[model samples]
Target: MQSPPLIIGTRGSPLALYQANLVQRLICEVSGRTEQEVIIKVLQTTGDQIKGELKYFGGKGLFTRELELALLDGRIDVAVHSMKDVPTVGHEDLVIRAILPRADVRDAFISVKYDSIDALPEGALIGSASLRRRAQLSVLRPDLTFCLLRGNVGTRLRKLEDGVCDATMLACAGLRRLEQENRITQAVEVDMMLPAPAQGAIGVEVKRDREDLTEILAPLNDRATEWAITAERAFLRALDGNCRTPIAALATLDGDVLTLRGEILAKDGSLRVAQTVSGQVSKTLDAYDLGFKMGEAVRDEVGGRITFDD
Candidate 1:
């Protein structure tokens, strides 16, 4: 008798579907499973249903909660997610089984007229839903105005064409995955705007008890990307970060040395605290410790001024 197919749960968005299908193809290649033996199951998430800013609702978890619940209930064997969207704190029963190779860890500046953020006219309107982007941009161009802009990649591009806002920002990884790299006016430098934690990586989550699935997915795990994101996410978890807080972190590995950069900004961009730390990290735990220490240092500097929406 044949065994049941492996079900992969994901959100119902163009980019989400693209990530899921990519995983499906990779799984088939690695495990030598026929395409028919692997399935993609699309599920609606709160992040998709809400037409307003995520901070007003529940923050990043809105995108993964439904899929996670499905995983807990045995409705899916695994779930694929954008690592940036996955909350640092997750259900104890679930674990990220694998991380695909990372992509360009940069934010893309998109506009119909302006060539880049610096080219925008004074008092120009910038549309984005990310507190990190808005806060960072506010510091760079205090004359610019910001308004809430929320949607998938296509929706936001259409809004830009419709003249809803002068400019917007998106993840370079998402645009590349969706074949919309041409839409990027400028791939913003990390020095100007550090990316959110775990940006540009794909994470696969599975039940902790699924040793079989873990082994099956092990071939897809990218060790360097795993170590980088492990540190970044640990920084986020240390600060209890969420959509409400403007937090950014990026980790890079050089041989056995790991360097992590982190930032915490006020909502209005009036104040910012940033820090960098480096250490020899032979394992993921070492990376986590390095990040956690950086986060604590930044948090302590910011003091009680850092507040969350909840």
Candidate 2:
């Protein structure tokens, strides 16, 4: 009898499929497995079925719960996820086996009439599904009106073309992955709009007891990206971050030094707190500590003013 083909589970979105296929190719090359022996299993997640904003619908887990349940049940060998959509806390029975190399960690401004965010007229309506983006943009342009926009990349683009909103924001990484970079009117700088924690990274999750699968996927992990994501996620975890909270964080590693920048905003974007912390750290735990401390500091600064009440 032959072993079953290695199944890689992922959401059915175009970008998700692209990432899954990329992982499939990399795994095949590294493991010397024939493409026939490896396959992708598309799974529909709760986030996909919802038409409204994600913040109101329980946030990040909606994107990964079904696939995770499949993993726990041994329905799939591994699951690929967009790290940004993953919650800071994870299922105890699973582990992120690998972290793919990072992609562009900046947000892209897309608009048909305006050339850039700055060029938009006052009171320009902006559409975004991310509370962080809406809050950050509100801080920059208080006069702008925001409406909920939710869908896959192509759907969002189509909505933009149909003038569903004057302008919108998307991850530059997704656009580049989908080969739709031309749609980006402006690649907003990180300083202008800090990215969500773990944005632009792909994570592969497997059952904690799957040592063989872990070793097989080990080669795909990038240490630097892992360090950065570790810190950012730790920061988010420390703050108990969720879709309801407009939180943004980015971590960068340079040699032995790691730096983490974080921002938290009021729901209405009326108040904001931002901070940066850096330290000499060579280990993942050290990176995590650095990020967690920063999150705690920021949370303390904000006190009880910010509320998550819907």
Candidate 3:
């Protein structure tokens, strides 16, 4: 009898490689499989295919499409992805079977003259790859200049030190995962800047029918992150958010309560609508209901103020 070979698909980036190995390591521990049992198969996605320009290629899914294809084609039995980059909506044939322990949920501010987004000089330039961060930055400091920057975490940080733009925004979780927490000048709170749909979460995507794999990964699941991302993704799906839209959300689970905060900004950076909701964590459907309500509320609050469409 021979053991089954597990092919793990992942994006071919430093962080992607790091995360893929972490997933494989954890799975092997839980399933009693040796390192040789799992093989990491790297894929280049649209996100990686683009350099120097992210807005032109696409948004979040740039790194996911290729690995997802590998999964669908059965070339890989599992896929590892940063939950925030994964998207709010799941696929018909695929599902996030587990969420590994989440990392920090803050945005690192890297700069020489400032410790945070606020300390930056008025009209100073800042770079970021997320529409959510750009839109929120607009609402936060209308005076500062926001530019589109695309690259891996290291590349972005290097640009900041090299003075490519002044300062840039990146997820604190990623920084922490790479043992670069000290680089963060500030870890902006969600109240001030709503995080992306699933920031800080690491998810393992497997074929929906793979119950054995699901059970194998179950021990590593972080219930709080899983639940929080579930609520946040539902919100994004309800709002129909995509490349063109500037939307952000974050949810927190404490005991039986789940707290959600969602925001939507106008395309031109003039108006903003934000909402907050809290409910029993078990009522997952309420998360969707609240997300929809928040979007509708923001739409009404802004009152034709936002027109960005994807």
Per-model CA lDDT versus the true structure: 0.93, 0.93, 0.80
Number of backbone collisions per candidate: 0, 0, 1
Candidate 1 lDDT trough over 10 residues, lowest sum: 301-310
Error of 2 at 125 (Å): 0.4
In model 3, how large is the Cα lDDT of residue 279? Answer: 82
| Candidate 1, lDDT over the whole model | 0.93
The C-alpha local distance difference test score for the whole of candidate 3 amounts to: 0.80
- Measured with C-alpha atoms, the lDDT of residue 229 in candidate 2 is 97
Candidate 2: worst 10 consecutive residues by lDDT?
51-60
* Full-model lDDT, candidate 2: 0.93
Worst 10 residues of 3 by lDDT: 51-60
RMSD of each: 1.0, 0.9, 2.0
**Which tens-of-lDDT digit does each residue in 139-158 have in candidate 1?**
89989899889989999999
Q: What does candidate 2 score on TM? A: 0.98
Over 4 Å off in model 1, which ranges?
A: none
- Candidate 3 residue 182 C-alpha distance from true site, Å: 1.8
How far out, in Å, is residue 18 in model 1? 0.7
- Superior candidate under TM-score, 1 versus 3: 1
Clashes of 3: 1
